[model samples]
Target: MSKQFASAGDMAEKQTSFTEIGDGLWAFTAEGDPNSGVIIGDDSVMVVEAQATPRLARKVIDCVRGVTDKPITHLALTHYHAVRVLGASAYGAPQIIMSEPARAMVAERGKEDWESEFDRFPRLFQGHEEIPGLTWPTTTFKGRMSVYLGRRRVDIMQLGRAHTAGDAVIYVPDANAMFTGDIVEDRSACYCGDGHFHDWPATLERVRRFDLDAIAPGRGGALQGAEAVNRALDSTADFLRSTYRPAARVALRGGSLKEAWDAVRAECDPKFADYAIYEHCLPFNVARAYDEALDIDTPRIWTAARDKAMWDALQGG
Candidate 1:
């Protein structure tokens, strides 16, 4: 029984919601869909993640408009995923900020990723025509950069790699809120197809050192207060550790890819099967983890053909 390739079979549009999670901060979440964030400064605004298309991004803009009239000044790319940065033009932000590696990623395989993601998740890319093409960041930084919207200070920091080679998190110290990209998810599946599986936990620990009162995850709802924030962090760490560690061990012992896949499923499925995109993410996640376990430090570029081949193989086409 072969499984569908990635999210190709998932076409249901999720219900989007905007929630006020902190002072001058908002979380735009779709029911188990890719999440985005907004931070309002006294004089300007920053959008954390762009939606899949310009049309979808307009909805996020409306959400921002509902609360404040500040001009959107900066659009931050948490990483270089097409769904997270392609709709950036919709914000019309003067400065599009991203890590250097993220910028490099856009240059490396941006077009291929765009077509691949569009093919996998058509519902999210409903307004694909509206996209101006691969979004290139106007500003690129190496590590930490401070952004100020008047008196408000937002710290954009790259602790280490997790979901991608350049995962970044936005922190508002005064508000005690953090907008973590795909580095940490509340309930949504951790799509590790481009991740650094072995180092992900260490990176999460670096993020944990900060005193965060609330967190707007890359997916799922905003986690409010310290307790909820801590829980989400722990859950994300557990998901990474549980899935990758076992897969790595299997690969180290020269186990079959299917064996590693089954091991990951046996460990993660019982607890995470109900999470959003779990089924869609598992095979890819396991494959990447297996590669990492076998001494492959970098993830292979996922083209449309590669995605289908990997899914078909592990799912037994």
Candidate 2:
């Protein structure tokens, strides 16, 4: 309780950018906040990753309006994180989608996640009061599903579990572009609270196989061109390895969580000190890594009280 979450005091507004990564494909990114993607189809539009709240979602909607007047017919949520799906109501899209596991997570811990995330970062939840309740997917798929916005085909698939158990990536074949939710971060730290560390690299490899020309990642700017996309993938992989190795070492050696924290910081700081959300994500990442190292396959749900207890335990050292 003595040390507040790194994001708790992050009240400064971030400059927003709407960049077109592919033909009719856009990425809406704030300085280091959560990001959203847009896919303008032949007739209608498909939006990827709703913002944290209605007011936040309105910003993406405004950006969408600037480019096309097409109605958003489908909203695809990559995962069940509150920051990513709580604002779904703003879209009012007739069909909202998520992976089956993601919806299951929503049923399991959606409220806890919403309360936990809101307490951790107030800036993202600007209009928290406007959020009716937990966002539910009108439709869900087990491994993969394809939706057509007229001629454009969006392949939403659960390649593997990385950021969450049911992470889905939106791949548009026409543009050879992919919208990777938190699975791929460009110059931003991956929030690994509910992540699967061992499964992440393999999932990322599944993404790399596409050899995408462009990508709208979960955070940071839009990745255009093959090189930038690959660089982000490599760096994200490196970040995950860097974070996990030290924590795993500590946990396997019967060291305390505090020791794991220090070890992880020692390894990650020099490399990712300036990355967006690096500090905010470290403790949770370390805790999860420690758990994963101890053979815990599933990530523990993060309630607000658990967040505080984890923070306090690490700070106690």
Tell me the TM-score of each prediction against the true structure.
Answer: 0.97, 0.99
Model 1 ranges with Cα > 4 A deviation: none
Candidate 1 matches the true fold with a TM-score of 0.97
List the pairs of residues colliding in candidate 1. none
Q: List the global CA lDDT of all models.
A: 0.88, 0.94
Clashes of each: 0, 0
lDDT digits (tens) for residues 1-317 of candidate 1 = 44565477777767898988888999999987889999999999999998888888999999989998989998988999998988888887569999999999999988888887877788888868878788998998998999989999999999999999988899998888899999889888999999998788898888788868889999998999878888888999999888898899889998888889889888998899999888878888898999988889989999989887886677662
lDDT of 2: 0.94
Best by TM-score: 2
Q: Write the per-residue lDDT of candidate 2 for residues 103-200, one digit (tens) a residue.
A: 99999999999999999989988879999999999999999999999989999999999999999999999899999999999889999989999999
